[model samples]
Target chain A: MNSTIARLTATGLLRGWRGLLLALLPFVMLALALLVRMAFGIDPEITSGLLDTFNLDTVVPLIALIVGTGAIATEIDDGAIVYLLTKPVARGRIIVTKLLVAITVTLLFAAVPTLIAAIVVTGAAGTVTWAYTVAATVSGIVYCAVFLLLGVLSRRAVIIGLMYVMLWEMLVTGLVDGARALSIQHWGQSIAAELAPDAITASLSLPVATTLAVLVTGMAAWFATQRLRSLTLAGDS
Target chain B: MTSIHIDRVSKWFGHVVAVNDVSMTIGPGITGLLGPNGAGKTTLLSMMAGFAAPSAGTVTLDGDPTWRNEQIYRHIGMVPEREAMYDFLTGAKFVLANAELHGLSDPGAAAKAAIDTVDMQAAADRPIATYSKGMRQRMKMAAALVHRPSVLLLDEPFNGMDPRQRMHLMELLRQMGSDGRTVLFSSHILEEVEQLASHIEVMVAGRHAASGDFRAIRRLMTDRPHRYLLRSDDDRRLAAALVSDDSVVSVEVDSEEEALHVQTSDFGRFTVRLPRLAADHGIRLYDVTPADESLESVFGYLVQS
Candidate 1:
């Protein structure tokens, strides 16, 4: 990966009210978990339930989506990505570097927050908070990879990514049990179950879920590079 | 000593043709790509810069294919026509980023040299979003130059610059060209091209119309048989006096319209001779109009000839 491109990408993500606004999402999620705990008191069953439902399922994927899509879409839209593209660097290196930036942002904004929220609810019992943090990290990697590909592939990446999270993840997976095997949330759930065997559980086997997540993330990374190599500037002829 | 060779290159988007079958060899010098708007000049430059691939033929730099080639950028630097840059970064930071991207051994020194070359050191610390059009252009130049590529390609590089900035850029390009770095810039403005470029490649209607020394092509455009319709108090008398001179190749006195269509071989002498001939013949000159003065028509005449 090219460090200059990664540094530039990170600079873009961390600057402006965008960074402040995205930071707000995780804290707000953690605050809600704290409020729920104060109201109901510390019960592993209910605490894990809150962490799984609100922090992992909803918050991680959404924050990952924002960071991932923002990584390259804004530059591509304004044509500033030309600075990176016109250099003597390999296209794959640039794509991977940008993906690195997006994943780093997701780790800070989503995964770390998931751990903190888990602690506020259950106080780190049964290694449950650590398991959910690992789960959040895995989900962030998968979601960021998917959304980064979408950002490079199309101009409507944010809209399309939101639809994928809201409609396909919620509606389709909720309705069709077969769809769970292909879902990112299910993959994270499986991993989380394996990590915290006594506290958390999932529907799929460990091998199938891990393999799907790994395969999809790798394929997204590959396609993002290939698409970036063929990207052309659109302008007046 | 780098050269770009575009051999019979053509680019088309769906049904619209941008650059038709065109061929040219641009060596180490300032070569102007001259054409009016929508004449496919940018498409040609884009191909040279490796931003777009030609649909039909190939564009090569020093015998290696340009399209889909990342290594070529090591020796090539491009300033695209669009003004969009990373606006959040300061000018120095932006150029330094470009230098670092090129894997320059001493990126800081290179960025410093580049910014100083553009005479923008004083404003290098300012964010690009706060720069004026001319300053932004110079910042882009600094960035492009930071890598010290042997070849430089700029599209509409003088679009929004004031006269002072334009002259500064022209001089900078001239110095680069003199240093044996291949420099090519595209301009629709004839005067800008004429004043700076020693050689010119003219594109008209997506086709390569002419290529040679700028002054020679200018002469060709001037020397092409100019058809002028003259209306005066005495058209036949003026025609008689105009034909008496050698500069007037053929003079047609239209009795029906009461005008004279005069075709001249020597454009320079003909204009000087007109008023003198009319005055000498005791004729009142009502009007003198060049019938074909539009740029397209001039290019069309060149294409047919």
Candidate 2:
């Protein structure tokens, strides 16, 4: 709600080594896409393999973890959040502002790069670029909200988020078909499937995925704001 | 005027009580929250700063609840005890960000003013990561003051500062208090609290031990029966002479240690009288030390009283 707070949060996020890490994910994805384009000559199967296996599976979650958790966790860790908390601004406004910053970072680092990388791998034959790009963008926003809330809730947010992203999403979801229905990546892929005619495979229907995505994102954001309302300053104990 | 009123507030973490049924009213002026380390000073300050919620009762500023109330920050500025801050930004930029967070119209001017107030204008452009402990403390002060809040809560503000920086900060706090701003700073150093605060709230073991002027607390600290270890050339002579004096309550000659353990009710009279008596009798005094001069003992006495 406060533009200045959003600006500050974004500026802080992009200030140091953290910004470099954020930029690294997209660069790696792009580099892989360029290598695939040169080596395999724009094959749909190759693009699908790279996009489904790496971009959707790996890059999206990692970027989300970094950007989402970095938005608020760093401030809370260093006790710099007291500056923001000791203001007349609403707690919800603070969360929303940080969430906006996290979303911007995630989109730039994950979504946009996925779009460009999709173009490089698929050329113009399929809607893989647009499909994965939308999926990444939507998933990126949800990850940012969920992880930003996690950052506010726990000091060990990064560790827990990495577990959720790596173990829960990749390992559990891959083994169990029902687990895919509960995955943010799957919901995102479902939306992406609707975009591309034959470029991607989705586990869920469009209506169900859309409803779940909206519901999860909304709920995560709401929960984050609620958690922040009672967020006790560390070192008080 | 904003005044923080802590009414029978107690805060516990699990089974450990950090602050227990403590109550105090902090109004306009510099009030020192003095206690030894881990005496719930930070916990009490956190509750007052609206960072921690009390388990029971209330902490309010001008009748408005402090806990979970973001609006109370409009009149309250806090300098937390922790050393960590946004190390990436320049001191001026950090202060500006804080000002902007407070929705200040002219953040630049406010930041500049705060930096100037802390006398850090010369180093405002440098990154806080490169700052010394004293400089970081000053920058933190500048950030806290950027919004010109009425109530300033500082926890261990003089922790790492040298004597010169301490004097400067003390003067600044005194000036703020004189200007009718409610300034509360916590410290364990008795001299530091005595030098600045006209009013002090003493806490020991999570309870409010004493609350009043520094002189009154000093009286309470001194009025208790003081035990002194006296090592003289002739312990028997000193002990024999001291026991007969009206000021001395009891005297025991520790033959093994070659010292006299004396308990005196009138601290002021006993100190002068004992040394004078020893001198008059030609007794060479080797050592005269207060047996229990630690802040903990003083605080314990206050708590017991």
Off by over 4 Å in 1: A43-50, A197-201, B225-292
Tens digit per residue, CA lDDT, model 1, B240-263 = 788789998898988888899999
TM-score of every candidate's chain A: 0.95, 0.95
lDDT of each: 0.88, 0.88
Residue B242 shift from truth in candidate 2, angstroms = 3.4
My TM-score estimates for the predictions, one after another, are 0.90, 0.95
Q: Candidate 1 DockQ category?
A: medium
Model 1 TM-score on chain A: 0.95
CA RMSD, predictions in order:
3.2, 2.0
Residues B168-281 of candidate 2: C-alpha lDDT, one tens digit per residue = 999999988988999999999999999999899999999999999899889989999999998988898888889889999999989888888999999999988987999889
List chain B TM-scores, each candidate.
0.93, 0.95
